[model samples]
Target: MNHPLTDVTRTLGGIAYGGDYNPEQWPREVWREDVRLMREAGVNLVTVGVFSWSRIQPRPGTYDWSLLDEVLDLLHAHGIAVDLATATAAPPPWFTRQHPDARPVTASGTRLAHGSRQVFCPSSPAYAEAADALVTALAARYGDHPALVVWHVHNEWGNHNALCYCDTSADAFRSWLRERYKNLDALNDVWGTDFWSQRYGDWEEIDPPRDTTAFRNPGQELDYHRFCSDALLTRHRAETTILRRIAPRVPITTNVMGTLEKKVDGYAFAAECDLVSVDHYLPAADPDGHIDLALNADLARGMARGRPWLLMEHSTSAVNWQPVNVAKQPGEMRRNSLAHLARGADGLMFFQWRQSRVGAEKWHSAMLPHAGTEGRVWKEAKALGAELAALREVTGSRVHGDVAMLFDWHTWWALELQARPSDQTRYLDAVRDWYEALWTLNITCDLVPPDADLTGYRAVVAPSLYLLSDHDADNLSRYVDQGGHLAVGCFSGVVDEYDRVHLGGNPGALREVLGLVADEYLPLRTQDHALLEDGTRVRQWVERVETRGCTPVLRFADTTDGGPAHGGPAVTRHSFGRGTAWYTATRLPVTALREVLRTLCAQAGAHPVVDAPPGLEAVRRTGEEHAYLFLINHTLDTAHVSVTGVGVAGAEITDGRVVVPPGDVVVVREDLTIAPA
Candidate 1:
């Protein structure tokens, strides 16, 4: 792989062992001891200068790279790779005092007073100028250094961000509207904004929708979120452009917080970077790791569209940020790390290789704790290190996929922007519903963005769509009509991006075409589940509708004598256009999802990637010479994995069964000489 990051990757080889390194927060002599301990733990990469902006340039027109210079220089001499940072996490106190507009405003109407990093307003010229200047200075000074492998733009950009509605942002918002609408006429249609006598006569009348600032138009508020995203992107580009000028080939990236709900457009931002990266932190007590870990990894993996990325920050144990902090049990850390890797991550990394002596993260997990490497954390980290050191040769091993779930930003934005009938209707949950279903079927599915073409994929699942452009709808219709298998979930195709429901029926444009009739309905009450006339309870809340002409495999069973069934037409199938469409009226249980997905799987004729037991996960990745199957037993009990795709030489599981222990991993490889079981 002749990647622009090849040289950096050479140094970033095997496993990226080191994590956050803030020598500025420690004594100089401690740096030596830290390095000694890091070497003992096989630590190689040091992410330094994350929050050193205040120290780097204490004032405008001043530079103090001496400390960072020493840090980077020492790491270079020691053969440790350095992910040199922009040191722009925080604007110095003097810069903020001099240019108060440099601060950001929250969605709530308030001017932010900066006391923390990540408070700088992306819309402010002062902040942009300062950030750009700092990046330029750092890259220019150390671009060619052997130790500098990656450019970390800034520390977590969307972590409890500050409010900043200075004059600059307001002016920029108007300008943004000018470019988007060209005139107010086109904007009014998308927003239907004049219904409340809220028509804008000029661009100057436009402003960000702050919570305290009067009116609340869905279109305006949503666009404001989009505007904020674009503004931040503009600022991010400013710094990346500087890095491009200096280290044109060095991979540039930033660690995005897992499952970030901020207004920032990470999907677009990923396109600008050479490599995508994210921090991972999921609580041990989470009923399921999907919300905090699995789904986050899937989203990040999807952000890059199957491209390999770095797990920028994750706790080796519990994180202080979660409501309840719980450490990873005996082998839980490795299991969790492998979980992300199975989702297409090429590298695994964590936050704070060394423990922070103070701050909110002081109690968080670390490899070498304040108690030192002799402890349990260090032992676990060392084991992880050994796995990577031994498996270095498979650095670029890829996860092969022919199945993908269509994920979209437009859909995410549109769906979230809509005020749905139920409060539980959400973009992430909708996605999770589909994912949890597929994962249960022992099927490993890739998350794909709508911008990607559907080629060679057996099936594409799009659920709770709630939004789609006319062009996109046509594109989808064509895919299915052309002998392709597609599965869609509830509440889809109901509205356009403007939050206005398409006329005719619940699923609007896709209704008749998908062979389904979703008429306006009788919603079920809370604590009650939908029931099919067959007497089976539909998974979650649902709507009752009339299904005529379509094959109603199951009908809602109304318990109250005179009432229309409180649930949906349990399962309905119909022929639309040139393909077959099946719709489930209500959400399904995990078991039901798997059963339905299995049927869909057989319909699509796709095969499971592994023989994983319940509570375990399995995925296979194939390359030119071999296919690697990762069997991760997420359960505490040992599980059996059946053999698949094998022959004489290197067929370890050919005898039919392989026992994988609790929280253990099995990396079985084949020469492609085996059958596709």
Candidate 2:
């Protein structure tokens, strides 16, 4: 089956560069000025009418399109395209007043108010009907408008109102379970309800794993997560159906929050979008925030199945929500934008165009700050816009990585459940450690689902994946058996899809393929550290391992403490049918892990794009005719690089060596045409 492609260049003719334009926020007189500034800044695209539900439909059944029509006309006249929004993200006050049940109810049974955004229940009929009507009206009115290029669906689905544990949701859950399990006996068996005499005789006994005295059943909680993710996706599909029926030519997309979003399955949600788009922000306090940015950009590209994605929303400076919204220093924003572009983002945008003066996000940074055109942010935004325009040839290019990291939403949810081995075992931290090592080595990585095709990748890494389905386990085993390299981290393959223990041994389904059997879990205390025979430090967790058909590469150092794991295998290697499988029973420090990965990558035939200096980020995006090498110098001191390519104008490239100044980006395009030797 062929999916509709999201081609932004078809309409914009270049890389999409702009932010969210909210004309309704300002007086009508200021609208003209917004367009003039946008033209001067080289903004070719802007998202319009995202949160304009109340303004568009003042009363229950009335709609006023005068404001929207005028806004679109002005943008089109100024040569700017629109990513018109459906305006159903936030319901108006009148909607909540008429249908109070539409308000999302908390797990504690408190129905939230409508003062904030995304306040509607996912399963409420009233909310669905209202949203559907609004989407239909917008699609019908502006389906053929010249200014419109893409139909922006609801803003950030599952960000705030991901789950609603109301009676309506309970009924929906029961129905969803019925379609999934088909009978009470099947549901009971999968949920392992025979434990603690909690077997259910009927569907009525089942409910969401809502507030409980003790730890709720892990199986029940896992299924409930699946239900919630599907519920929100159902809403997105509803709006998509209306849009495709009315305006099938215009591609539809809703901005997705990157790794920060845990409530919804991002991979499943992305499958519904014509174009995969993500909204990412830097951690204000983290000095190495650029590393996280690269991680998410690669994840977004993976979500798009290696296609170029859009950077829908990021801050030009500080955000308002954090405890301390630290601002981006000079040249930081430019470096951040190009880093994303280098990683495979075709369109770059921000949270907003103009800063707000009277809202919850008044302090949030924007392209046009509160200080207006005189601010540093505005000047940088213009320069970045022009740079994006010059790099339009990169729009359809794709980022290629020899390494793939297995990331699963269900595994993340189940791994963090109560009554686990260690509260210190965080899914994000474990995954980041592996990605950071790859990033430091300048080796590109793609965060892929467990079921993704592994033949194309040279090496695959699965870290802290506590839950594993039988099908996915078979997939990984098959990949390894077919001469592919694989590395399984600690606590992986412990449970089935229902969160039930695999019963025979630890890492149940993968034991045979991995050639190892884990006996007992040894979760370390907060301050405890274990030493490896190779003088490497292991922290957080370890396990008692008994090698089945493998060789121990690294063993625990001998100790006088008389611990059960005094000299056990800390890491092992197994040759499984023409390929190798590596397993780690303990968490290696990031620096040590980097060396381990370096060896594994070398053995697996995976190499970095370039040998970059420390603190300098390097990545490559390849197309049919050219390959772009992006060298971003995050360090303070100027550095020189050796690469043969044509540099963008103004870049300091001479002969084989290129000079990169401190805190800047340089894109070197390598022509694919080979000269006769």
Candidate 3:
């Protein structure tokens, strides 16, 4: 499948830039003004008809093409390409009323009312048929439209209604289990149902892990999560099948919420898309949201298998959903957008072009805010559009990473079950902690799956990988044996894919490779802390480690002071085969973690792209002709980076340095002929 970036660059002649265009929300006359503004802002592409199901199909069988036809024609006439949606994201009221069985039910057996979007059950046959019928009609109508460049299957799958515990979904789950396990005996053995006397004699006796009195079966809960994700994928594939049959040439995609999202498995979702597209909104309350943004961009690019992906949706300013919606500063939005581009986003877009007037998201930031063209958001959008227009040559380029960070949704699900270590130990927090450590060092890294090929990466880091399959464990062992560096964080490799224990000490799978035996887990109490030998602060979790052959680099502080932790290794390094494996038995602060990773990376030959200050982010994208070096200055003061290339502003006389203003971005096109070592 061809990536949308490559296709958009070929057909539209530059990077794709635009936002969602909802013509149904406004009068026809307002659309002309919208297009005029879009052209002024340098938008070359816009998504249409995402939430227009009710507008398109008011009744069960009736169709209205007047509004969508005019919208597409007008966009084409204005030289703007269209990312036409399947319009199945939200079903109309009439259809829901007719097929009430398709309505989603809660885990407690309550049928949810259809007032919000994505309210239909994912496994409901009626819902699938209805969605497919709508998708078929849309594809058959606009499959060959001149303005159509991409097929957006559905909007943010599993965002609102991820799992449906209704009977319809129950039947589908039973069928899926039958196909997966082949028989009740296999299912029982895998689920470890004998412990709770929950073993099923017949497939019909099974149900989803609903709200039970006691702790539900971890195995069943984990499988239910997997089933829900796959059910959503099945619906997505159904829509894509019809689109492929009708418009095989157009690239198909659905936006995925990156690392922070725990519902859908991003790896599975990425495989289904022709190209990866993601929707990321900044953490409104966090002081360091940009770090989260960088993690998301890296994860999205990783899902694309290192191919250039698209920024499908973001906010121009404050999103309406946060507890206290704080607006973006003067240049924050620009920095945010360019930051994604610097990572690997070939295209940039927003949630909306024009802000809504009478919807739940009316206050959500958009290209055209409620204050109209006179607002600061509008000006920044225009400036960013022009900047993107100039950087068209960077499209289809690749961002190469020096290290690979392992992330898995299944591990996330299994690790955070009801009964585990302290709830303070979170899966995403561990991933982010390690990622931030790498990011702070200016070390470019790829977010990869556990079983990914680690031949090229100099170092691989696995954080909070609590669930491990035998195949993936062997893959990691093989990677380390082949002279690849491996760093295993705490609570990793503790359980198999069935959510059952490894039947030995903690971190069971990689214990042999790590050359250590974890005798017990020591998750800290709330507000408690532990200290390393060198006074490095550790918190949340720790492990009592007994090294077999590896040497301990950091151990618990002595017991004379009487702290929460007294002895044993906090971190260890094992020389295995031709490579090295590092183990972190306790959670270290970002500063401490960075130093540890820095040491490992230096030994493994994984260095930074450029040695600049901590706050200045540097990433390079290489193409056939040139290599574009993107520098984002997130610090309070200006930064002087050492580099020699043609600036985006066409500045040529380089004195081996580029000065980036605070909270700003700089892109320099270097010669690709001088290949990177």
Candidate 4:
């Protein structure tokens, strides 16, 4: 499980505890003050040179390294390691002026001008060539620098220009399709071009799926998304190849905006990185934002295959992008940082070190806010850094859990197409609901892909998986047959990978495994409600299900017309092979869903780290010789959790008996014990 970038010697202080440092924006004298303040705050690392393309390469073929050398040398003198960026995220004005064709074109056919970051088309040959040259030069210059530990290749790909429909992109897309389909006939059949007279007789006849009169071809759109992802990956690989060639010992990575970003596949992108890194931001106004943050962290760890990942960027307080920017309350920042560490993040960094004085993000919170070092934000940042340094034993740990929730980018894309069963059906919302229910029960779960290995999990939950490939369907079936418990939501297994409905029945390929057939989909309006067998009211959707060998776990109330759906199965359980599958026919209320999940976890013999009270979060991370338990209290009142089975002889428990105050964390370290069966 050891990655090239995770070695203790390669990292700073065994844990990175700084943020993005842009000393280039400040005066030379300010750089000395910045380094001094960084050391005082216990910062061991900083990401430098991001968004400096214009400064580094003011004009094409004219390079300046004076400022960069000064900054790197200053950081090295202060014992601060650098996560060096390639400075290719935003092209300089000169490059764009020289290559006008590099501008990205939107789906509306309007070519975007070059005033913003990521304005260059991903498939533009001129842009790619320019970027490659810059990256090569950077690697050749600083690949062996003493301050460099990690190479950050371009910031957040596909953030702004994920897709481009210009002629250059169209040609690249056509070439991509040619490689995939090999012939026009194969492409026609897969795309279902026979419908709507959209069949293409020649590869040259196709173009990017621009804004259309009606709905665009779903298959074509899906393929276009795939092409866009590949195009960006191509750019990433080019830079990574050059970096690896020059800095053979250094690790290269790019920050991924996890689940929040829908354009790129995280698993595929993680494959290109030496280590998985993610930028996670939470809505400051949402009361349930912590649950979403935990879910995203779990997904990042899963992307790293259960190994520790890097928390590349988060805010010290309120982010400026939201409609209402609310700063974090006292103790909230430390709680957020520990939550990520509890979920298997090896390093914790923020979006920035010092607050920017200008630009769109001038209002964004940073470690050192506009109020200076005397501010509460800076005080909290220093405290958190010291705490993280004290808990160095928790670095490079793994999180163990027996429950998993399935997440797939392709399914997310197809489920939310323009035409769908219900407008209330949001992919992330539904998944978050189930994940939050489990969170309340103190049951930890991994966010896994549909095709991930299921043998290690005692139970799996698939929420609103509308699209399924035959391979994934078979994999789930095999998992159920081999003594795995599964809970599938309504509207699942309804379509193939191409967004085409399965012909046989709803939940077509999974009928045998589920032991039920859905005859019709009943999408209720926003305010509509239906009664479950337990007298629990549900809403938004219901399935008219007929059981073959499945036993009804819940039934719907009688309909107004007394149709066949009246008193039909609302939830069913089938005993398949040595395991079982539970199907939820509608979206149940929170209380009802929690009860159902509790029952399922009991049946699967899944146990939480400790029996925690409400509003208290419990998670465990296991290192080579010890298991660290984190108990965080999100409520205003103090919360106490039992530590009977959580600790071993001679164990150290911080703050005594896992008692956590409001918005505080308690860490308990014990000898590693075997997980309960």
**Compared with the true structure, what per-residue lDDT tens digits does model 4 show for residues 1-677?**
56654673246766778999988777899888899999998888899998998888888888898999989999999999999999888998888899998999999999999888998999999988888888988898898899998899999989999899999999999999999989999899888999999999989999999999998898899888889989999999999999999888888889988877899888888889998889999977778788888999999988888888889999999999999988888888888988999998888899899999988899999999999999999999998888887777778778988898898888888887766888788888788888888999989899889999989998998976898988999999999999999988888998888777888888887888899999988888776677765667777888889898999987887765322366998878999999999998888766777877888889998877788888899999988878888888888898876673343322334444656678878887766565655
Whole-model lDDT for model 4 versus the true structure? 0.86
- CA-only RMSD, every prediction: 2.9, 1.5, 1.4, 2.4
- Least accurate stretch of 10 residues (summed lDDT) in model 1? 645-654
* lDDT (10s digit) by residue, model 1, range 1-677: 54433345566666566788889888899888877777777778878888898788887879887898888888877778888888777778898899876677666656678676677777888787788888888888889987888999876665655224666788988898889988899888887877888788777887776664454787876677777778877777888989998888678998776455555666777888788888877745666873347667777877766666778888888788767887778778877877777666666777787888888689888888877867888898887777767655445556655457777766676666534576556677767777887776667666666546776677777766767666667767777777666777777787776666788776775675566667665445565565556556654346555665457655667565213445447567665555556666666655666676787777877777765667777777666577767777777898887765442212246376766777787666666765566
TM-score of each: 0.93, 0.98, 0.98, 0.96
Better of 1 and 2 by TM-score: 2
Candidate 3 least-lDDT 10 residues: 558-567
Please provide, for model 2 over 501-583, each residue's C-alpha lDDT reduced to its tens digit, 9 standing for 90 to 100: 88899879889888999999999888778888877778788889999998998888878331347699988889998888999
- Best lDDT goes to which candidate? 3
Lowest summed lDDT window (length 10), candidate 2: 1-10
Cα deviation in Å at residue 385, candidate 2?
0.9
What's the true lDDT of residue 363 in model 3? Answer: 91
Candidate 3 local lDDT, residue 170: 95
Give the better candidate number (1 or 2) by lDDT.
2
- Quantify all predictions' global Cα lDDT against the true fold: 0.72, 0.89, 0.89, 0.86
